[model samples]
Target: MNPGKRYLFAGLTVLLAGCTQPAADSPPSGIEAVYTDFFKEADTDRSGTLEAGEIGASIDRDFAGLDLTHDGVVTIDDIYSKEQAEPPGSTRNPDLSSHLPYDTDSDGRLTAAEHRAHLLKLIGEMDIDGDGLISFTEYRVTRRF
Candidate 1:
């Protein structure tokens, strides 16, 4: 109710707003790093390629775990639905659900094959000039402020 208190609240609000991270739907600032991590984790055979089967089981499990309705498939909306349904203070990380926007197909589910394709497509888009690879400059420019 006091002017000084109001100004203090406003300043605190501004600082808090600036400290918040970008929404998950926004383009990530580490697209290249994401690619690297995905490649490393999913390339089970060390062959520099992501075989469909390598990620298949995990994909199936992710769908089964999130498909609370038992509909045999999971949708982007379902991820948020479950998030909201979670009990308070549960330790689940929501970052993985950020992959939704890149799901090209509207099937509301992503298979291992789809995940591989999506990552490749994302790399291509970020390449800008079709260089077939991401340079540090391109990576920084694509993901930087």
Candidate 2:
């Protein structure tokens, strides 16, 4: 092969090799799964946390359709008072007031380190087995509102 062709092939090979390596901060599949499930379930009121109920209630009251009986109590059937379910594609932050406050830096984005620390803390809180692992049931129970 010509010298130019040899160099070109070598560069291409290096690039292809790099594509298969695992990412530097990639989380384990199980941990990621737990994070996803717990976040979705625990953020029940969708206010972000448990405490967002008051804020959500205020917003609901302002909507015309919320008070079906006009009695000030928001029943399940009262569509106006209901908080919208979380959207499908993105992870929404739970209301901070509900349970624990998020440790977001002033800029409003979760740094990689923050994300990892949060996950570890959650695992520690939810792990009931004493084996340093969180079972699915334990995870579910801990995340319940």
Evaluated with TM-score, which candidate comes out highest?
1
**lDDT string, candidate 1, 18-131, tens digits:** 999777566543665575554456556766543446555434554577666676555655576776576788765444345465455645575545655665565566576674
Best by lDDT: 1
lDDT for each of the candidates? 0.59, 0.50
lDDT of 2 by residue, 1-145 (tens): 9999999999999999988846747643665566555454544555433223432343343433444556553233443225577467965444422222333553333333443455556656876766554455565568662
What are the runs in model 1 whose C-alpha is more than 4 Å off?
1-99
TM-score versus the correct structure, for each prediction: 0.34, 0.29
Worst window of 10 by summed lDDT in candidate 1: 49-58
Error of 2 at 25 (Å): 37
Global Cα lDDT for candidate 2: 0.50
